[model samples]
Target: MDPKSVRYISECFVQPQYAPEESKQPFYLSPWDLAMFSVHYIQKGLLFTKPPPADEQENFIGGLLDRLKSSLSLTLVHFYPLSGRLSTRKEENPPTYLVFVDCNNSPGAKFIHAALDMTVSDILSPTYVPVVVQSFFDHDRALNHDGHTRPLLSIQVTELIDGVFIGCSLNHAIGDGTSFWNFFKAWSEIFQAHGNEACISQPPVHKRWFPDGYGPIINLPFTHQDEFVIRYEAPQLIERIFHFTSESIAKIKARANSEYNTKKISSFQSLSALVWRSITRVRRLPPETTTSCRLAINNRSRMEPPLSPDYFGNAIQTVRGIATAGELQEHDLGWAAWKLHEAVLNHTDKKVRGFVDEWLQSPFIYQLGQFFDPLSVMMGSSPRFNKYGNEFGLGKAVALRSGYANKFDGKVSSYPGREGGGSIDLEVCLPEASMHALESDGEFMASVSSSN
Candidate 1:
C-alpha cells in the first residue's frame, strides 16, 4: 500500500428508540426496511477507494470523515416515547459510526480483511447501545504474506501489497441498495475533490422521499392476513458474470421482440426475462407453486425536487411480479417480459407510496422479517464500467468484477465494458450444470465467443 494514502472506515448503527416490553405490542422490521438499511451499507463500500498519495491519504480521509460526521449529525438523536415497542419509523434516523483502521503494522490487504472480518462479526453481534466505534492497528506477522491471495481489498506498493481495506458492517435496518450506492458515489466525489473550496457545499437532503409503487407488494397481502410471515432467509443463490457484446445483446433483444411483437426491450429487461425463464426451467418447481420476480428500484426522483445523488440516505424501493407455476411453464418469453415490465410500471405510481406509508403504520409491523424470498432473483443494472479510467495513473483495469456474491436463489447483474466494448456485461448465478449446459448450447456458445 502507498504509505501516503489514508484509509476511511465507517459503520452505520440503528438505535432502538423504544423497548419492546414497555409497549407490549408486537413490532417487527419489514424486509423493505432492512433493504433500505442495506442501501446505505452498500454505498459505504462503493464510496471507498485508494487515495492518490501516501502523504495526502490521511488528510483526505480525515476531511471526508469530518464532512460526513457533520452531515450525519441530524441522524444522531435520542428516542421519544421510550416505552413503546421498537418499530421502524417513517423517519427513522440512524447514526453512521466511523473509525480509522491503522495498517502500519501489516500489509494493507491483510489489514483490511482482518478489519472486515472483525467488523462484520461485531455488527452481527452488537452488545451495547448506540454501537461503539472500534479502531485499531494490525500487529500480526501475517502482513508479510501475499495480500492479493486474501479476499480483502488491498493496495499494492513496491511489489508488496500493503494497505488497508476500509470497510463497514452496517445494521440492515436503515436503507436498501440504491440508497447505499447513492451515498457511496457522494462520498467518493466528496473525497476526490477534498480541499477544493467550491466543493465543500453539502448536497440537499430530502427526508420525505419514498419508493414509488412500481412493483407488486407481495409481502403486503400475506402480512395483512396474519398468515405466513416473511423472514430473512438467505437464499442459496450465486453471482457470476456472463460476457456478451452489445451486438449480441441487440440480436437477442431483436429476436425476442420480433417473436413477441413488442417494443424494444432493454438489456436489463431481456436478460432478466432470460434468467427468469432459465431458473424456472432448472428448478422444475411444482406446478402449483407461485413464483415471483422482484427488482430493486431507485426512488431518488420520487421525492419533490429529487434527492441529490450525494444524499447519504436510503432511497430505494423494490417491485415484484408474480405468476403461478403453471403460468410460467406455459407462458412464452414475451409473456414473462410483459409481466416484468408491468410490475415495474405498477411500482412507480404515487399510490404505491401510500401503500408503503400505510404498511409502516400497520399494527403487526414487527412480526415481519428483515428479508423476503421472492422466488429470489436479484439483479443490479448499469454498474459504471469505465475501467480504462481506473488507470490509477497506470494502464486501464484489465478486468473488473463487482465483488458481489450471489446469496439468493437467483442473481444476475448487467455490467458495462466487457472485453473493452460498449456491450452489456452479464453475470448470472445458476447451478454449475445449468451454466455448462448453456455454454454447450451452440447459439449460447457462439454468443459467448463473439462477445469475447
Candidate 2:
C-alpha cells in the first residue's frame, strides 16, 4: 500500500530520437556552473504526476510509460544538453576545464520503467513525502564530469495501481530550474501535439557567455567525487508542504505593508517574511544568533542587458537578509517581510554585474555546505514559473515535488499551486523536532489552509 514498497519492472536508456548533427563537441560551462559543482543534481531533480481516477487499472502504466519515453525521445533532440555527458577540463587554468558538457560520448538520457503495487493516494496523502522520492535513480556517475556513463538528464516512471509517477533529474552544471521548466513546457507542447509541429515552443540557447571585462573561468575546489558530494551535507530532516490560501496571503500582505508604513508590499515578501519569523520562533535559537534569509534572484532580467528569455543555463544569484534571532522572533510578520523586501532591493545593477566578476576572482561557493546552520534558511524557486503549465492531455499536474535532494535542512521552495486560485505552497524541510514545533505553532498554523 506504500509507494516506497514499489518494485522495479525494467530499466533502459532512452537516447535522443535522432543523434545531433554535431558529435564529439564539448559545450562550455561558465563559472556559475563550477560554483554549482557541490549543489549537483539533487536540487535539479523533481517528481511530477497526475491523480488516477478510480477506474484506471495498474496495467495502464505500461502504455503510459511508452508515451512518456517516446515524447521524451522527441523532446531530447531539441534539449540535447540533457542527453549529453559532463567532461572535466583537467587544466588548472582559470575557468577550470571541469566546466563543460560533452555531447560526443554519452548516449541519450537514462529512462527507467518501474511499478508500484500501491495506489497513488497512499503516497500522496502524507504531510511529508517519504524516502521513496529518491528511489529508482540511475546512480551511475550522475554527480560528476568523470565519464560517458552519466546522462545529464535521467528519468524514471513508476507505475502505481492508481496512476503514474515521473521522476526527472537534470545536471546543474548544464541547466537550472528555468531550463527545466522551459524544456518541460516545450516537451508537453510537442507531446500533446503528437509530434505534428516542426518547431519547439522555444529553441534552446546552449552557448555560455560572459561580460566583456570578465575572464579566467572559476574552477571547483574539489575534484574528487566523494569530496564533491560532501559539500552537500544531509541531516535527518523531514519535509512538509504548507498551503496558504489567497485570503491568508492578502491579510499578511496588508500587515507587511502596514509594518513599513508603505502601501506596497508584494505577496512573496510578506509570505517569506512570515516563514522566516515562524521558523526562527519554532527553533527557539539564542537571541544573539546570527540569522539570514537568502532569496533566489534570477540574473536573466537583472543583468546589464537582460539575457534572452530562452537563455538555457544556471542564471540565479542569491541575496541574503541578515538579522539576529532576537530581531526576527520579536518582530511582527510585517517587520520580517520588510527585511526581505529591502534585502532584495539592495541589489544594484553594479552589484549584480559584479557577481560573475567576483565569482571568477574568488568563486561564490554554494551554501549547501553551510545548510546545517541553525540560524539560516535559503528561500528559492520563484512561483513565477508556470509549474502547472504542462498538461500533456492528462490534466494539469495535481502537484509538483522537488523530490528528496532538496530535503536538506535550511532549504525552502515556494511555488504557486496548480489551482489558479492565488494560493501558494511553501515546501519546508526541517528536522523532526523543528517540524513538530512548526506544526503546532498556532500563529503559523492559523495562516495555513492545509499541509498536504
- Candidate closest to the true structure, highest TM-score: 2
TM-score on alpha carbons, each prediction = 0.55, 0.90
- In terms of lDDT, the best-performing candidate is 2
Among all windows of 10 consecutive residues in model 2, the one with the lowest summed lDDT is: 139-148
lDDT against the true structure, per candidate, is 0.40, 0.71
Question: What is the lDDT, from 0 to 100, of the residue 398 in candidate 1?
Answer: 33
Runs in model 1 lying further than 4 Å from the true structure: 1-175, 190-194, 200-238, 286-288, 302-311, 324-326, 363-376, 381-406, 418-422, 431-452
lDDT of 1 by residue, 330-417 (tens): 8776677777777776665474556666654552233212344445456654444232332222223333333222234465555565
Model 1 local distance difference test score: 0.40
Kindly list the per-residue Cα lDDT of model 2 for residues 48-126, writing each as its tens digit. Answer: 4544442555445655677778888888887887888876655544323355676767767888777766655666698
